[model samples]
Target: MVQLGSRAGAPGRHVVLCAEQISKSFAGVRALHNVDFDLRHGEVHALMGENGAGKSTLMKILAGVHTSYDGSIQVEGQAASFSGVRDAEEAGIAIIHQELNLVPELSVAANIFLGREPLIGGVLIDRRSMIRAAERLLARLGVTIPPETRISGLRVGEQQLVEIAKALSLNARILIMDEPTSALSSSECDTLFKIVRQLASEGVAIIYTSHRIEEVLELADRVTVLRDGRRVVTAPIGELSRGAIISAMVGREITANESGKTAQDGAVVLSVRNLTLDTLGPHGWRRTLHGVSFELRRGEILGIGGLLGSGRTEILESIFGVSRGWRDGNIAIDGAPVDINSPADAYRLGVALVSEDRKERGLHLGASICDNVALPSIGVLSRFGLRSFASERALAADMVKRLSVRCSGIGQDVAALSGGNQQKVVIGKWLGTEPRILLLDEPTRGIDIGAKQEIYRLIFDLAAQGLGIIVVTSEMPELLLLSDRILVMCEGRQTGILARENATQEQVMRLAAPGMAAWSQVSAS
Candidate 1:
């Protein structure tokens, strides 16, 4: 853990970045009140807050993404005004947003040097040199990516690396990262942390934001608490434990999930046997899901646990009918075979999925909250080849109320909402479908504690109504609390199935670990 602060005014050491009495508002609703914050050179400053706590608003003001904020920002002991993101970059500040800003059609090199590419003799374009330069920059950040590869061909983790490389290419003095590790696996996160340490060593000021308190303690040199747009306290990482940080962030006590919930009423509602997908990949017709089988019951929550590339995602994909063609499978809903060839087909048969990646697979960010929330039920809102906008708005308003979604209005753009609110919209969209079965993939991964609690309550509510739910999550405590049973996968095989009564963190880890069990026997015990 990092120490909170050093002695006051000991020699020529002042903050490199400082904000005084910052305030912001939208339509008379104050998002951030008078808040003061600072970042010193060679320090990792963690910003802590919950949904609607105004952390993002403050960061946006500092990044110059919002010019209407009222504040005095001093850089290197001189007051400065930044009108736009470019101005901030020019001031040696860079922000890697949670939502990646890369163009998919462009190559890695092109994205890294997007607006400011090095020129050949200040005239002709130098493509080869740009690629080499991008490669070197990526290497410096401990990121391995092919510069010539199109960003569209990469996974979410690889694309995140591209964003980091872009920040490094600017040689920025201050770097801001918003939930950079929300989608990264353990190893990939290790790579990112290594780069953070390296940059801190070079005197680059860093402002880090994340929902994971443990990660903040491990990586941040100092922690800053923000609540309802007010600065609470700034302390060294070593000065605060995870419990204290959570209490400060939420302004309340949060009991950890110490024990697992007991399974109840386990009559199977969904059953699949001998499910196999033989698709040609880098390896020929490789068995991605080898005779996978599982059982889920009415009013039950089943968990699927595994690391990246452990076939956990494939199982969800197969169940949702999004995977490559599969063969010889017996899928039953209430002991009846159901044909599922597409998402619409599965949906019609009463199945809905909150996919693993929300931005790509779930939402249309440019669309309004009304449109996104009502998308799944548009047919019902449509009549005589015409849609009723009023009806759609009413339905959206109701769903928003039910989900406790925070937003400006149903007419507000989804992209403008906070990350947790955006995720709520995704769930609301699915809830509008009114499915009998729900498959959620990492549903609460990036959300704050308050929003997460809402989602958990919603899950239990849905299950209480007798809707069978299967959740795939990397967070073990979530599995313990939200799931009635867990199915562990290791390398495209079913390793073990533990009921909540018998499921311990150690048991789930063992089943999800290497060389445990095959997919054929993974159960919903």
Candidate 2:
């Protein structure tokens, strides 16, 4: 492991990687500007900022993903420029992007050595040796996954581990992990942290990017804040607090408005009984949701909280027709049973769902903002084999103004907006359909505080108009603030449900965990 001098003035040490005057642009937008960064050997440097803060752009330049960047890179005190990722890898640099890059049908070993495979007899590919090498790498990282298993057969966490192994196979001295824990379970994250510590101990310089503030403070040795394509601040982890870091990233004061929701007495509008989804386990084992049920009244907000695989998301999806199977469940809208066999069927039944994966499943990125907003209600705007563009624009314009969606115009592409505004577009599409019951899955994920406030205001407005809302969230504070009633799920079952006035963070977390003694009592009550 190479040693480096700390900011506190230490002895002779080597700076493994250095960047000076890094500038990058896409189209006409400057993604990064004069960014100077240096990584010492055996250090985990965290890049902190909100979405679209140029952190990823800067890292992409270092990984050679963006070859057009104007910058001088010095590795071992020698000026260098990489034309491609292969060039960077040859220079001992590798990056594991936030999005998984692997062929689902391919085996773990195949993915590890995809571009550079070992050859045998100067002709045939060595399959057995590749699997053996993959197994060895997995063993070194303290992760247990069969090398012969296809990536499609593995969980998201296991696939992420495969990516890490792929980088390690390059003998990369500098590793960049982008949002590594975004899709990991708590135990899987612990395993990843252990591996990260091991790599740091072996003098591997890591540049980590994550939105989770707590994890950054715990793992990163030094933190760098970027805002609006410029470097804002750099300091050791101990020198900055969470509040200070957030301020640096946004360059302004940010605050969350705690919802003071008053208790509501309203008639039931939507009811679900015995909803279930069949799920496959690690080794082709099947698990079923055992008789999940819930009810929401008009002018009321219901919150769902659970672990990642606890069937919370599945339940909402089932209600919205995202999951299609023989659902032996009773779904009632306004005291009338309805068969929601498809998304269109659910929409006709006055039920709208904002899916968790907004970018992929909900919004059409290439479509204009007006078109995306009118997608759910395009039928209403159509007339005699022709659609009213004026009406569509008017509807979308009103929604954009009402939701405070910051966009250039109604003609702007949905992809041009920020994460928060994109989310508003998702909600707008549903609201334009004019559903009586709304189902939201992580609506506020990856958004800023001002946008969050706008979303909360919209939810409250809909509820006040006698609409029923069901929100599924991983954030405890969001669950507490926005819910009139809370339902907690664990291990494919309902663990507890509480009235919002009586629910606390401590109480919610206790019930949300698997196999607690309060499960039966809380469920019964």
Candidate 3:
């Protein structure tokens, strides 16, 4: 439905962008190696690789997100040095990252034209001109959202489209889309694909990257697969098979059930009855959750599934004693009623939580892994009034080795680590507390496939060791693969809890949409 660009034919088929001898490293660990890439105008070239394959690193270098990498990029047959993101934009290059980048407090139009706003009389910002420009832009993108709508109010799919509109506004000849479909629904993805093809037809050279192999195969004119930071294969999409691309990704064949299933018949370890929460507004308070209840058993992986704003996160935060609106709830652990009013109470009761935002809530970015892993259990690791540095180091080293975190050393800062390794450090730090129950919220959200498998295996191992675990995820394949039982939530209420053997995507989706249907039923695993 979107009109991306002028329908004029390309001047001619030619290579518009090229990179030579691209290499990047973080703290002595090589992330890329001599990766040569070139993009032809009017082509959709997909960059494929497993997590840690340097696909993102390579794209970052091209987009001027990382200017320190060892590489030489040529734009339009001329050697160009991009000093920063603005430089790349000036050179007709724009990128839409996997994580939607929009200021939540600003209006949609303000975000679309963030830096280069039209000014009147060389003085005040032209708000009226900005809205007109934004309206025209959104209409071209086939989106109906108002120009004045706050970004925070828009859904994920809508935000993604706004990002696309922003890039299109730049009029970039070379556009890079990184994992653009990750947050989109099926219909949203179809819309995105249609726009991508339209743009390509108008002579826009596109660099498309995604973890979904089928998507790459369908949309990409050429495919380039990277492994261990090196280019393994680059060829026309017709010349590559799905299995071949996958095998090149990980150097092995992987099955749908990567970690396999657990017995899932252990004793009930956590029981919740009639939990409720309310958001305090200026006038008073507004209710969110309505008497939600469920049970989690040891040696079992329970999944929470729902659409955005379904209160799936509220369930985890409330259970971990971090929710401000835990109005009434009865939580019993090991057949005894427990009161967890704070995170300390949850920790003391052998419960651990890995929040959705690992960077903000889980890890201290400036601190070393050694300090981070020992943070929660400092009291247990200490002797007398003074904390023992030696014990902390030993514990940190043990956790590093146990989790197989890819880092230069345990003394390295967590902020420098990759997305996957940062998550591992978060998991290791939490596991150091030796929790009997673990609650993970969107654990693999921004991570790669390989890292996801590692997390899945770790969860299975923990469950096998009699640790009860609850995972909340929006990824349907992940929920189907890991959950021994699935609980669907809608508008902060329990819609249904389904046994693993009988649970299906259609049923879960139905329950996820509020008032879509009468909940089939709910039963404990």
Candidate 4:
């Protein structure tokens, strides 16, 4: 490995990358404006801002993903202008995007060495050499994933690790990590932090971007915050507190832990009895969920907490009738048993699911905001057998206003909106259906602090309106904040349910830990 000159503990390291007067716009809208940034060798510089605050835009410009941006970049004190990602790579820059970019049909080794595979005799591909290299990289990261394993076979967190390994394979001097641990477990995050520190010690410059405040406080040497497409502040991590960082990012003090109105003891609205699900994996049928039971009451938020693959999302999928598996469960709405064999049935019964992956499952990116919001209510908005454009527009306009979606107009494409706005569109889409029961899976996954506050407020307002909500989140704080009653899951089973008064982080983790036998005692008590 090339040593650029280490300064692991020193904050005055030499600059490895710098950007001046960086500005980018999409169509006629300004996404970034005169943002200046610089990174030092062997330093983790965190770039923070709410969604659409131009962090992603600036990173794209640096990584050569957005070539039309107006900026001057310098590498090693030399003027650098990249026309494409290839140019950035040649300049020893690599970016691990927030979204995974891999071929699901390909093996891990193939993905790692994609577009630059080793060859024999200048013609034939050297598969054996590639697999060996991939194995070494995975081992270096302290993971045991086989090089020959297909990407589709791995979980989301494992896929993120592969992205990291792929970036490391480039031998880049500068690395940009965008929300790298959003899908990782706590143990996996610790491993990643170790690797990051080791790389920094070896003189690699890293620019980290995340909405996670604690991770930034722990990992970054210095932090820069942006807002409304402009640079707000840049300061050393030691000089910043959590409140300071959030204030700089959002331009306001946010009480993230402020308790909302307590849920009323309303009547039971939905109940599940001994729910079980069997999914068809590559190795045939595997039981994904077992004996999961819960009750959601009107004006209550029921939060599900668990590790990745611990059946948190599966529970929501099964309830929304979108699980790609055979499910055996008894579901009752208002004390009457109901059969939900498909999403249509669930919809007809006033059940709406805001999926975890908003880009893929929730919204149609290419469609207009009006189109996406009016999708679910199309049938109801139509006139007899004819489509009612006027009514659709009216419904879309109403939802956009109600959700406070920031957009030019309803005619704008959903893809052009920010991450936060896109999520609002997803929720608005479901709300148009006027569902009594709402299921939200990672509703604020990639969103920033300001948007999170908005969504939290929305949830509280919905519950106050007597909407029964079931939320599945990996964030412990979010789980504790939103739920009136928390259901902790481990593997496929229900561990225990803690009422809001008793739901501490320790108690939730104790129940969420796999192979723990304390559930019986907790349930009995």
Give the top-scoring candidate (lDDT).
Answer: 4
lDDT of each: 0.81, 0.81, 0.84, 0.89
Provide the lowest-lDDT 10-residue window in model 2: 2-11
TM-score of decoy 3:
0.85
Q: Write the per-residue lDDT of candidate 1 for residues 289-385, one digit (tens) a residue.
A: 7677888888888888876567777777777788875555779888889878788888888899898778788899889999998888888789887
Candidate 2 C-alpha lDDT tens digits along 1-525: 222323232112468889998988888899888988988887888997877789888888889898888879998788879899988998899999876899989999999999778899878889999999999999876677989889987645578789988988998999999888765555556667877877777778889888777878888888988888899998888899988988898787777665545436778899888876776545664554667888889888899987666777778878887674445688898888888778999988889999876876789999999999987887888888688888899899989998888888999999888778999999998899889999998887666545666788888888888889999876677788899888887777777788876888887767767775235636422
lDDT of 3 by residue, 311-367 (tens): 778888888888865368799998899998899999999999998768758999999
Higher-scoring candidate on lDDT, 1 or 4: 4
Please give each candidate's TM-score. 0.86, 0.87, 0.85, 0.94
Worst 10 residues of 4 by lDDT: 1-10
lDDT of 3 at 416: 78
In candidate 2, stretches whose alpha carbon ends up further than 4 angstroms from where it belongs are 1-13, 107-109, 117-165, 168-171, 279-285, 447-461, 501-510, 514-521
Model 4 TM-score, 2 decimals: 0.94
Which pairs, if any, clash in model 3?
A: none
Identify the runs in model 4 with alpha carbons over 4 angstroms from their true place: 1-8, 142-146, 153-155, 261-264, 517-521
lDDT of 1 at 40: 88
Among all windows of 10 consecutive residues in model 1, the one with the lowest summed lDDT is 2-11
Top TM-score model: 4
29: Cα error in model 1, Å: 3.2
